[model samples]
Target: MNGTLIFDGGCGFCTRSRNLLTRLDRHGRVGTVPFQEDGVEERTGLRPDQLAASVWWLDADGGRCGGAEAVNSALSAALGTRLPLLVYRLPGMGRLQEAVYRWVAANRYRFPGVTPWCQQHPAGCRPA
Candidate 1:
């Protein structure tokens, strides 16, 4: 489970985010798993809706970080630097980031190219 990111496989946005992370993870520090895939729920204990609400990161130390915390960690790891990491650790920053994340999550269906099935049945939509 170390350094793994369990994401909503059904969401186009999540797929694109995963791809961007993969490209930035030159040291192979990050691995991605789609929540809709077989065995993912069993392994992560996260239901599909939970995963859709936010990104989740399992660190090498076995600690779990979610929402904006996960995003900050992933970005810092991908960049191989500590500045962005520091920003995330700053007081109030994490909370602010999480707030923005929630707003975006709530409106993801409005984004172009979001599948019609996802728009019609958000909870039921699985990765295509």
Candidate 2:
């Protein structure tokens, strides 16, 4: 269940989403980081634009998935079930998930979001 969830630090919506994920992750099995942080690209091998486009999940074993798939992975780990992943794999469900995720991502700013966590707690944002 251990993994890293990379997200957009500048986007309030993304930050809030990460916070929600943290709450659901009672076990703290998933670690989250903002892609804007220094060396994130080097550590994840993901470009800035790619990270900006969608959330990413990097499993402990080095496996990676982005967009809706990433969400599925994070949720599965947090909830301790593969239901999300299973549903996502169902026929036509993947496309539906992708479309919905893209829509939300595109209109994320419209939804209410808290201030970026890093801006509020700079010292705690970066990994030591």
Candidate 3:
């Protein structure tokens, strides 16, 4: 389960989530990448448009996941348990999760007190 987890670098919410993942992934099983970092697009083959649309998880097997599924994968791996079990079992959960992810992706900038940079370049903020 070695792969990179790519996230929106600029969003405050995203950064906080990354921090949580970092703490949980103390075993170094997961790698984190902020979409705004240099060469991220080239390394991951994910364009800015695509990165901005959803979070991405590139699995060790070369499989790619996006939106809530990606998030669930990352969380499950980091949690090392069945925390994401419900997401995997519920009927229609994948479609519903993707739809919710899309709505959030589209409206992320509207979050209160978001930085101007985040509003302008939602895909380019990389975690520090």
Decide which is better by TM-score, 2 or 3.
2
Candidate 3 lDDT tens digits, 1-128: 66788887677667667778879986777787777777878877888889877889988888888888888888777777656846665898878888888887787756643343344555555543
Please provide, for model 2 over 1-128, each residue's C-alpha lDDT reduced to its tens digit, 9 standing for 90 to 100: 67989987777888899999999999878899888777888999988789878899999999999999999999999888889999999999999999999999888878888998678767655542
Error of 2 at 95 (Å): 0.7
Q: What are the models' TM-scores?
A: 0.78, 0.91, 0.76
lDDT for each of the candidates? 0.71, 0.87, 0.75
**Candidate number that wins on lDDT, 1 or 2:** 2
Q: Root-mean-square deviation of each candidate, in angstroms?
A: 4.7, 2.8, 4.5
Q: In model 2, how large is the Cα lDDT of residue 118?
A: 72
Ranking by TM-score: 2, 1, 3
Question: Which residue runs does candidate 2 get wrong by more than 4 Å?
Answer: 123-128
lDDT, candidate 1, equals: 0.71
**Residue 23 CA displacement from its true place in model 3, Å:** 2.3
Residue 54, candidate 3: alpha-carbon lDDT: 87
Residues 1-128, model 1: lDDT tens digits: 23788766666666667778889888887877766656666777777667667778877886888887787777777777766768977999877888998887787656644344344445644545
